[model samples]
Target chain A: MLQTDQLKFAYTGGDTFSFPDISCERGAHWLLLGQSGSGKTTFLHLLGGLLSPKSGAIRLEGTDMAQLSGPALDRFRGRHIGIIFQKAHFVNALTVGENLALAQELAGVPVDNGRIAKLLDRLNVGQKIHRKPDRLSVGEQQRVAIARALVNSPELILADEPTSALDDENCEQVLHLLTEQAASVKATLLIVTHDGRLKDKIPNQIRLDS
Target chain B: MNILQLSWKNLINKPLSMLLSTILFALGVGLVSLIMLLNKQLDQQFARNLEGIDMVIGAKGSPLQLVLSSIYHLDAPTGNINIGEAKAFLRPEHPLINRAIPLSLGDSYRGYRIVGTNHNIIDHYGAEISEGKIWEAPLEVTIGSRVAEREGLKIGDTFYSTHGLDINEDLEHDDAGAFRVVGILQPGGTVIDQLILTAAESIWEVHDHAPAPVGAAPAEEEHDHEAGEEHAEGEEHTEATHAAPATDIPLHERVDKDITAILVNFKARNAMTLNLPRTINENTNLMAANPSYEISKLFDQLGLGEQVLRWLAYIIIGVSFLSIFISLFNSLKDRKYELAIMRTLGASPGKLFLLIIFEGLLLAVLGYILGILLSHVGIEMIGQFVKKADRYGFTGKTFLPGEGWLFLGALFVGLLAAVIPAWQARQTDIHDTLAEG
Candidate 1:
């Protein structure tokens, strides 16, 4: 389970955002809907422990993320949360399987190549595990990125505009794959996006105002 | 993957930049190491042989040339000195001198010099006979260990002498009877190791019958001219001369005798003996040069060139550090997003910092290993070309103790070159970088 109450954040001498409170049970799917400049990405970063909030409590599985800092917070995030960015960026020097292995290594967990292969096969990217992220097609790279995120079997999956760069057909397929993979891992999935095509893809939604 | 593996992968990803930095660093290290090796070996050879002997009495010429020729056998002797004049220091009753070993030069057997000296010269260098007996008769030769090994001359083997030190010149003394190898010395690691030893009478006998108007002129014609002058002096002094067997006459009585140099050791380091070189240089025709003084002066001159080369090597290392810095800095700029992604994957800022440092360290370590190998190979080639392999007797196989310090210095250079770039990598703004991407 993941929950946030009145999460607030501000960039240095820039816009401040006060996010709406949201709570989700384990393995639940939620769409965090927002227009451009609504600070949806900021809220997602604060929830993922990538950014510290000005004032709020982001509790993930009963632990407040705001209380942890430095390596401890980074480790906790690695063990319990998974994040996917919009553009499906990766360490271009590593192959797909190596990227997944790096994620497990950084999390201080013993890497399981079998789990990695199974996850990629579930995402229909089993054949691309040996390929570099750059050499893969955009859809294939996105699927590989999904495998990297779920490789650690975290408790929460945070996707920030992951489908914004995809076409309509890819957007639908990726949404279906994200929910299926999240359910298999029994993880709470929250997708933050400004793409309107994903409006009806998930019934549960939370909207951010300008 | 571990941070070290990540660093390695990143370096291999951009092979050109890594190779350029590594090669630049290696060249600088190689040059500096070569100079260090050469300087250390030269000092060892000079110091080892220059021990015990105090002054070299020879013909008036460059003092350094006299030391090099008489002590190191690395150059031609400066003409020759008359044995009558040099015999003053050779007397056992002399107050200032303890031992004086006279050397007669101007002949070689296949490029190795045949030094005509007494048995005291063998004891002077701490040489032991490995085979056969010492040369007691004229024309009987005792070859040094190196000469014996290289010429393959054993006891009872006979070889003819050439006119001068050079082997390229075919000024063979066919008229002179072949000198028999009577003894072989154990390796003493001195100039004596490359010489063929005999009594002073053998050199006189060899040149006494040498036919005039030789085939090829020796490089220093003054040697032959001085020998002729001594022969002329001998004819005026005695009737029992060149036709008489060389073994029949004593060395001191033969006024026709001319020695190349005399290696003198002082009885005590008193003011009189300390001033002996100056007194002999000013009071006599024979020039006296202190071996240590001349060797230090030689080093002072060589030190200047070594200092310049060391500075050049340092400058090259500095440029290589800069190259490494630029390469890492540029790569950091390009990999900002990926570094942020690593952060998201639970790589701490400190981890990123170590990653960059490891990358720099890997390159430096590679350069250092290659550099040391390059320097030894370079020195080996130079040793072969300069004929120092057997003569001065140093090889590239030697590893100096100072190289351990050099290794630490290279690692420091790597750490220094990576500081700023690693700092920037540590300060990577994860949220902003991810948002931008």
Candidate 2:
């Protein structure tokens, strides 16, 4: 359902391409592994509609995301995309449910308390609905971020160093949650990480320099 | 997430920055709100005072000053006219003339001044007594509700009159006389609350039979000494003193002789537009000032006075908008990877742009809420100070927003400020941002 062609992108007012041709397709647990400044993150952004490729096209359910404008693209992204970051990007002022509710609202979906409650339950942090992100532990916060990302039931999941701050045991649990949720939705999963420990478990990886 | 979620996240991401922005927005909008409240209350007050009268004729001085003093009770009176001269103009056959209620003011009981007038004053003003009927005769008084309450002066409470504008001894010509609060008038929300309403006979009576202080000498013997002294000095002094026209006879014994100004009400539609006021001013030593005209003139300098303040508020609001723009723009640079990741997940660059724009919109909504709250509180605070000053006698104590449309405009500006920055974020290159992720 998701595919990226030989995507090429360059920064405005600069001659250098940030990354070379990047390609991705659904049904694989893909990992963009590279050293810092090696363009692995750049490759992930290319697949993500956040950056338009100068010489490539990205197709999500056969519609090019790079060409849409304004609210149309926003609604499209809200419904079809779920992103996780290294740091939990939960809104600090909002309680956990409110944060997730915000995500649901932005995606043009009604706030389904049942789904959100179940997600928080599966994450084993059901009691923290009213707690703000700042008051949560690092592991707990990451769980909230993961819940927010998957809450919209998008067809694609993107995580950037999502498990870096987790303890070894929590890291395994978080990664398992990301992969399992993506599989449940039949969504494509992409992890941009320098964490080599993930390679053996995913069985499919895309090294940025390869 | 769309605008609400994304915008909320941005605001929460940096708690300190968001707080600062909200505070700035509140200040910008609060000033404008305060001015509106003041204008509304003061204008309401000015309009109330202008009611029930067409023209105010007073001692020849600045017409503005006369209106302010007679009607508003805020500025100095132009001059005091003699009752004989003022009544002489009331010819029985005059065509444009209607009821002329002469107002003689000088003495005050406690903090409120005594306004000497005939029953025509009560009839014209229709001031129903909140507690008792209107004053019956001279030396009788009708007090306003505020005055009665503040001074604890009930219907029979008698307070000694101090001569001149206030309760002081500087211009102490008479201090023995007193005004008995005869009636308490209803709350009219005008300058009348600070007035002591009585007949012109009351003022003449207060001056008459004014008890001499505890002393050995008497007034008739003293007058002989003054007359003997002036006579010995020159025959010219004797002539001038005699020329005073029986002014020595305390006229209250025969008739009321001290009407400071006559407020004339004419039925002619164009009476105020042309001849009457000019005739009154030109023919007599008294000056005629139109209350509506002068009061409106006070508010006419709006381009700089009120408008400038509003413009300054707009500029402040603009600055806040720019601040939101800059903050969102900076966050955009930082969220490049985040946006890129969302894009890869199938969020189009357009979606990303919308997300950013929506974030801006959210910030504006938040700022607007805070600004409106601050405005309400600000008006309340202003009301407190104005109540304390009691200079202009504004009746209400709450900050009431008069122009709801203007408030909506402010809200729109706040939203626009937030959206611009968020929109700018959507324009960032997802391809490049994801690379750095």
Candidate 3:
């Protein structure tokens, strides 16, 4: 469900910051590891359709990511791709459930309270639904972001250095939850990070040149 | 859950700043709306009485004052033109000089000042008498609805005049003539209702002779009870020298002189091509003023106050916009990861752009609603103050909604101010924010 061919990438205004060819199939779990400034986040941004390729094409479920525009890209991203930022940012003014509800509304989806409740319960962030991210613990915020990402059951999941601040045990738990969510959706999961400790947890891995 | 709640919540997060901005927006539009409303009401008030006998040739102090006092009854008139000189000026080719109504002021009956206009003021100017006929002379009178209600006068009732611009109780110093309330005029929503209507002859006749007996009042030849009775009671009826009607003349003709002003009308208003300039400089003693031009010039002279208020209002609005901008701009530093998280959630940059702009548009609309409400309430408060000052003989209540354009304009300005920041959000780099996070 994911395809790339001769996918060389470069920053639009610069000669450096290029990415080598890489491709992954549906349900594949992979970790992209690199040192700081090695462009792991940039490559993940490209995979997530958050950045347009300078010279490569990204296809997901036979649809070219470059072909979508405006609301189409938004809709495609809403139902088929989910991302967990390193810090689990949220609309701080809103409660957890409302944040989830907004993702659905901005994506033009129906509000499904039952599903949201079940997702919150599974992520262990159920009681925090009525609270804003600013008031929640860091772990709770991470779980809330996970619930938001899985709320729409997207086809692909991407995370950008989401476990850097956690202890080894908590990092393992978050990684397990991320993998479990990807499994439930039958999605391909790609995680970008500079840490090497998580290398053994995933079967497939790509290392970027420093 | 939708954009609206998010917007409201965002604004509520910083109450002090939100309030400051709202006040700024309110001030910008509020002042402009106030001036426009007052100007419109005053203009309508001025235009209403600008009817009939086409020229006003008074002693030229300020024609506006002459017009205001004589026609609109707002101030003391520039002193009266000599009755003889006014009539002589009408001898020119102006056909519409068809009639004259010399107004005589300077006395008050209860807070309503008594004006001496031609008795023909009723028919000629369409002052419909709801009760009785027009007064025939100075001592005979008519009251407008407002005057009648305030003083409680009716036909056959009489009242004595006090000596100034407003109500006073020097009844012993009152004029010897007790004005008969011959008529009570209807409500015309014009300056007429605030006035005590009387013939111009009555004004001149009432003040023309001092210590004059009431029986010898002008135009009383047909109705003076004392003259008729004394004529019958004595064989030497001519002995009461002052007990005769001064003239059996019509009200305007009885004046036998120039009017307070000449109200000129063209055979057609388009006749101004030949008349405007000639009319402006035609007489050495009189100056023809274009009402609109003069008012505009007056606005130019007083432009400082208007500009200060206008800019103050705009600056307040500008500050409001900046407040909104600052709120969002500061919030941007806090929301980097969240925005990046939205990006990973497949949320397009365009949706994020809408979020900021939506907040601004909502703030502006709320501020607009509050501002309009404040303006109406403010004007009503002013009206009350004016009405209570009615003791000074001013009609003090006027505020209207035709001035909505000012508020609408402020709202549009706010919408435009939000565009830049919104565009910046749309173009933000998800990688930078996410990487930083």
Candidate 4:
């Protein structure tokens, strides 16, 4: 479960944003939509604990994110939250399996190859475990990124415009995979995007103003 | 996976740049190590050859030339000294002198110097006869072990002596006589290993028929038949006393004898140790040159060239460090986004910093190994050249005394070169970097 109350943030020498408070239950999926300059990505970053909210109390499972700082904040985020970037970027030098293992290591969890293999098999990318990310097709790469997000079985999943660059068919497939993977892990999912194509798929939505 | 594995993968991602940096580093280390090996071995060789001789007394010329010729036998003699004048220190009653060995150098057998001296010279070098007896008769020679092996000479093999130090067959003294090999000295790892030893009278006998040079009077002493009897009665009769065949004639009267030099070893801490050199230099026609002083001067003359080469090697090392720094810095800029992605995956700033540092350490260790191998190969090539030039083989396979310091120096360079890049990596703005894409 995730909760926020009166979250407001501002960049240096930039305009401030006052966000609407929201509450989401466990195993629920929601979309955060906004136009360009609407600070949609900034809001996602703030929720992911990558940026501090100027005035906020973000609660994830009854723990306040504002109280955590430095390494404590990083460790808590790693163990409890998973993030998917707009572009599916990977460390080009490591194999898919190694990347998955790295996610677990950074989360301070013992590496479980069995969990990684099972996640990849469920995502229909089990054959790409030993291949470098650069050698895989775009669809495979996206699936591997999704598998990485679920490797640690975090409580919340945050995706930032993950399907904006794909075709309509790939966009639908990626959205389905993201929601399915989040459901399988019993995690609350939030996707922030400017694309209106995702409006009909996810009924629960929060729209930000520029 | 681990930081080391990640660093390794990152390094290999840009194979060309990493390879270039490693090669530059290897060249720098290899040159410095080669110089250290050569300088150490040459210093050891010089010190080893100048072991026993305290002072060299030779004709009035350059003291360095005298030391080089008499002690190392690597240069031409200054000139000849009167045998009668140099004989006073050879007397057993002399107070300051412990031992004095006379050397008459004029001829060579196949580029190896034929040093005409008494048995005392062999004793001073601790050379034992390995095959045959010592030379007792004129024109009978004892070759050194290396000389015997190199020249393929054995006992009773006859060889003609050349007139000068070089191996010129045109200057061969065939008319004088063919010198027979009577003995072979054992290998002493000194200058003695390159010489052919014979009695002092053989030098005088070899040039007995040649006309003496003008303006120099060959000192001819009349034989006091009683002194000859006394010499035979008193102590061991030296080979100088038996130069003449007829008993009625004096030994020096037969030929005006001249010696090239006299190597003297004084009694330890004797009062005359200080006074003898001054007395010999200022009073006598011969000059006394200290082997240690002359060798130090030789090093001083060679120091400038060595210093310049050392600086060049250091500059190469500096350039190598610069290349490593530049390569790492450039790659850091290119991998900024990837690093930001890692941060999102829960990698801390300190871990990213260590990953960059690990890359540097890996490059340095690989370069060090390659550099040491290159230096050893260089040493082997130089050793072969030196062995061909002189029979004295250069021992370059041994590790140098300062190599441990070199290892530390390489590591320090790697650490220093990586500091800025690793700092940049640690300071990466993950939010801004990820937002760009």
- Each model's backbone clash number: 0, 22, 24, 0
Best by DockQ: 1
Residue B198 accuracy (lDDT) in model 3:
66
TM-score of 1: 0.94
Summarize candidate 2's per-residue lDDT along B100-194 as a digit string, tens digits.
Answer: 67777666665567787766666676677788778764456888777777778887776666656655654343443456677999977667776
TM-scores computed on chain B for all candidates: 0.91, 0.82, 0.77, 0.87
Which candidate comes out best when scored by lDDT?
1
Q: Indicate the DockQ of the complex predicted as candidate 3.
A: 0.48
Task: Write model 4 residue lDDT over B1-437, tens digit each, in one string.
Answer: 78998999988888999999899889888888878887888788899888778888998989999999888888888888776777776665677778788888867888899988777788788889899998877667898888888889998888778777766777676655578888998888887888999877677665653333232222211212332332233332233344443323322343346778888888775666967787989998889999999999999888888888889988988998999999999998778877887887788889899999988888887787788889888888777886666655676578876877888888888888898999999998878988888
Q: In model 3, what lDDT does residue A146 have? A: 84
Candidate 3 residue lDDT tens string, A99-121: 89877776677889888888999
Going through the candidates in order, their DockQ values are 0.82, 0.25, 0.48, 0.60
Candidate 2, after superposition: displacement of residue A103 in Å?
6.9
Please identify model 2 stretches exceeding 4 Å from their true place. Answer: A1-210, B1-6, B91-93, B169-175, B209-256, B271-273, B301-304, B344-391, B395-402
Per-residue C-alpha lDDT of model 1 across residues A74-139, encoded as one tens digit per residue: 899888999988988888888899999999999999989999898889889999889888999988
DockQ-based ranking: 1, 4, 3, 2
Which parts of model 3 have CA positions greater than 4 angstroms off?
A: A1-6, A12-34, A53-59, A62-74, A193-209, B1-9, B58-64, B78-96, B152-157, B171-175, B199-247, B251-331, B390-412
Once model 4 is optimally superposed onto the true structure by TM-score, how far is the C-alpha of residue B207 displaced, in angstroms?
Answer: 3.8
Chain A alone, model 1, TM-score?
A: 0.97
Q: What is the C-alpha lDDT profile of model 1 across B149-238, one tens digit per residue?
A: 887898998878888777744587766557888899998888888899998877776676566535433322433434444344334212
